[model samples]
Target: MEISGSAFNSGLNAIQAGQRRVDQAATEIASNTLPQAPVETPPAQQVNPSPSGAANTQADLAESLVALNVGKTEVQAGAKVVETADEVLGTLIDTRA
Candidate 1:
């Protein structure tokens, strides 16, 4: 089946967006400076608690890595779609000529 140019453009756009997300995630992971989500504790449960920076950081890192992996997969899929579209278009043009 043939794909339109707009479809190909959309695929390329997806690739660009996915790459940006992957890069941002990598940078955050490498720098270890991701912003932490505020931890909320009920007043009743607020019994003196020790600092949890280490735990928070570990959880954040894990989440960031997962996001990075997902972004990488998106980029790969987008690139494949664009590639296939290009090939199909090329074949169509050749056939027309």
Candidate 2:
């Protein structure tokens, strides 16, 4: 019994995708955890273009949460692909024996 090239390639791709997802999640977590720099305001300019620094922080937190969820989903899907590939290979080996 011989393994097809496509299956081998797919397994590699799945592993790479899973690693990428994990890396992305770590990066997002680190960046979100860092303290944000204080916004500068001039005494003469009373009006601010944005609502407030707090609002920006809230938005960043929301975006980070979304990214984390997406990253978790991607990693899970990739793991599944790799698991399926391993199972198929194992079955092939069993049959050969």
Candidate 3:
């Protein structure tokens, strides 16, 4: 049994459409929104700006502040881990020699 060209194309189209719908639904459910790939970020959503650029600026500032705090936390955690490892290595060397 062989399918014609048009039938094959229609089947492929249905498969593609199903895949897109699944992708969209997955995005909506995860991460408050899922951007399929982190390397290609979605553009920021635009809010009304006739009179409230201040609010937008403030929001951007707030997002930066939170991000900065998270970065600081990770740095602190990494430092602690490195420090512990250094101390262990020093002790091992002292005991070996």
Candidate 4:
């Protein structure tokens, strides 16, 4: 088995991508959870809260949470790949001595 620079580069890229994903998801979740001022409704019209709107927000929150978890897993896997590549390269160098 041979380990090369490409393997290291791929791992690094994966780690970077995963980190970006995690960051984006966290930002989204934060924004979604922020409190908003209540809007005043006219006395003549009764305002009914849309259940669908609430459901949509909940769905988005769920998706963001999932993305966050997936990103963490991706980073861990990438780190392992990089670690394995480094170990293999070190062993190869040691055998040459």
Worst 10 residues of 4 by lDDT: 41-50
**By the TM-score metric, which is better: model 3 or model 4?**
4
Worst 10 residues of 2 by lDDT: 1-10
Whichever of 1 and 3 has more lDDT, that candidate is 1
**Best TM-score among the predictions, by candidate number:** 4
lDDT of each: 0.85, 0.69, 0.50, 0.87
Q: Write the per-residue lDDT of candidate 2 for residues 14-96, one digit (tens) a residue.
A: 66775676677668767767877876778678676656856876787677677667766766666676677678878877899
Can you tell me which runs of candidate 4 are displaced by over 4 Å? Answer: 1-3, 40-49
lDDT of 3 at 46: 40
Kindly list the per-residue Cα lDDT of model 1 for residues 1-97, writing each as its tens digit. 4346876987899899899989988987987875667789888898867669678888988988998998999899899889888888888889999
Candidate achieving the largest lDDT: 4
What does candidate 2 score on TM? 0.64
Residue pairs in steric clash, candidate 1? none
TM-score for each candidate, following the candidate numbering:
0.74, 0.64, 0.44, 0.85
After TM-score superposition, the amount by which residue 94's alpha carbon in candidate 2 deviates from its true location, in angstroms, is: 2.0
Instruction: Using TM-score as the measure, name the better of candidate 2 and candidate 3.
Output: 2
Better of 1 and 4 by TM-score: 4
* Per-candidate count of clashing residue pairs (backbone under 3 Å): 0, 0, 0, 0
* CA displacement after TM-score superposition, residue 50 of candidate 3 (Å): 3.5
lDDT of 1 at 17: 88
lDDT of 4 by residue, 9-53 (tens): 889999999999999999989977888777777777856655786
lDDT of 2: 0.69
